[model samples]
Target: MTEKPRMDVHDLVSEIYARDSRRVFSTLVRLLGDFDLAEEALHEAFAVAVEQWQHYGVPDNPRAWLVSTGRFKAIDALRRRVHSQDVREQVSKRLDELSQVNAERAAREIEDDRLRLVFTCCHPALSSEAQVAMTLREVCGLSTEQIAVAFLSAPATIAQRIVRAKSKIRDAKIPFDVPSVQEFPQRLESVLSVIYLVFNEGYSASSGESLTRADLSSEAIRLGRLVMELLPDPEVLGLLALMLLHESRRAARATPEGDIVLLEDQDRRRWNRTQIQEGKELVERALASRRFGVYTIQAAISAVHADAPGTAATDWGQIVALYDILLRSAPSPVVELNRAVAVAMRDGPAAGLSLVDNILERGDLAGYHLAHAARADLCRRLGRTTDAQAAYERALELAQQEPERRFLKKRLAEVV
Candidate 1:
């Protein structure tokens, strides 16, 4: 008889680790009540799994196995810290109590651990950059190097930020529980911003061969849904809606060969109508509440695009008007760049080029490749081949993603 191909035990462990690591980590944090201890215990448990699962085959309940092992690991570490028998006995007693409580409350408590963990990482005491770094590292399970690349910072800098953030949480005694209703509004904004940042990175990876990091985007959306379920805030709904609306077009965002297909060129037929419809409904709800914020406005803008049958059929005037509102609400150079594109659609390429130049003159986006790429497209349309070629070359130098680099190179070839 022919033998079936044997799966590599290491690969099997890796797959299980990838799928269950977050869940197991959440439970560990809850049990240990210390980030540093929980992280250590979690890794130790996984290491033990690598050794044991090879001989025993994978556990029927991998997450449970990891969590139990992590809990014991934490107890062992605590025992080692205190040489006194009395202290060890006290620690053992506490562990017994915790284990019993966990057994009784595991299902419900584990479900909420992630939400609580998110709130703790996004505590206002931490700087915005630190909060984002911590969330990406702890909650999203991204490595420091990956977080650094996503945000265009050095890995050491990102590592320092995460370490400092964790130290602050410990020093300040930040509670690892959801904020009260009174403090929810302020804290929710930070949480939403982190989630949106994650989604944006996933939607358009900073540097890579692939145009999209679907896993990151999907994780962000999942977190958004969890936030909405727990809080149900208008802004949270809007945030989720915005993500869904953008994700609905993900199917058509790039060519089969992974080159970017501009919004005007994407095949609209491939858009996920279900997500668009849900996003539109959420946008309407947020708008009706009149308590909506930046996310809702962005979702409203995306809703307009999703409603259009084609690029020409899009409501450019409304889009430009929405951009005007967005600019007034949350002003940024990136917003201005997008508004310029809308203005171009509404007015003319010359008008857009003029705004792009103004942004460049201010040095607001001097190193941003998209800014130069937009200028190149406008220059090409206006028959200024020399200027277009220079802009494209600059954009190509600044571009990090392989697909974007290819596209810029192609544009430069045309102008040359």
Candidate 2:
């Protein structure tokens, strides 16, 4: 007869990491009363768990164990700082009190702490960029390197951003609970934008060795669901739909070797049917209410792409019409660039080239990588080798992502 080994220890550890991450973070936030300190405490506690869990066996309540460990670390860190004697004594007393607190009460307190931490990170007082970096680091549990990829910045730059954001949170005395209904819209919009940015970064990494970061995309999706649950709105549904549609194609967006695969060239058969179905459902629901935002419109465009059986079969005219609506709703250089691509598809490469050249003369997208790439593509289509070669070289010089740079270089070589 075989005995089932006690749940594999490594598996148990991983489960603990997942189930208790928020709890650990929340408890640390309360104990330290600072986002950066809380995060530092949480990691220190995890380090201890990795070392001690194997010897002690999994605790009956893994989250409670981690929370307790983090709280202790927070107190120790405070005590190490040579503050006023009264401050030191107060912290010592608090540590003693924490040791005596009941585990059940601590767990309940941790929930409230997490809610407070969320509101604080998403505070309207902070700039949108700061709010995003802070919330992702504090609420979504992303490391600086992961956030850097998401923000399209160097890791050091991201670290500085997070540091400055936390300092602002502390200095501004940002409230730690949800704002009143009157204040909710502004705060929530900031929060939602951050989540969407996270999803976008993962969906199409601006620059990375890998084309995607599933962890970030999943985290953003989870955060979106949570946001919608807490405060359901038409815009929230629009964001959810947009993310679902984008994520559906993730499986087909890159080659086996991690090269970029343009949407038209992607293997539709490789798309996630379930995600596509769910996304379509959301888009339908959002559209039924007759409340279409930028996200909804973008999702609708993606839906068109998803529904088409092949590139040649695509409903380009409809897409061009939608882009017309989108431009009015949210006029940006990037949106204009995308509109140019759609126009090229519906008309001809020459028409698209005219629009792109007009834009270049305006010098609005001079530093934009996609503009150069788009021009190169249009020139290639028109069989203008000299123009194509120069455009590809320009794109290669401006391209940030390694894979995209490779793509541009390949195009240039072919032209040469």
Highest TM-score against the true fold, candidate: 2
- Candidate 2, residue 169: Cα displacement in angstroms equals 1.9
The parts of candidate 1 lying over 4 Å away from their true place are: 1-31, 36-81, 85-112, 124-168, 180-183
Report, for every candidate in turn, its global Cα lDDT versus the true structure: 0.86, 0.79
TM-score for candidate 1: 0.75
Report the lDDT tens digits of candidate 1 across residue range 279-372.
9999999999999999999999999999999988999999999999999999999999999988888888999999999999999999999999
Using lDDT, give the best candidate's number.
1
Q: 373, model 1: CA deviation in Å?
A: 2.0
Give the least accurate 10-residue stretch of model 2, judged by summed lDDT. 1-10
Clashing pairs in 2: none
Question: In model 1, how large is the Cα lDDT of residue 148?
Answer: 77
Runs of candidate 2 with Cα error greater than 4 angstroms are 1-17, 23-33, 36-116, 124-132, 143-164
lDDT (0-100) at residue 27 of candidate 1? 72
lDDT accuracy of residue 352 in candidate 1: 93
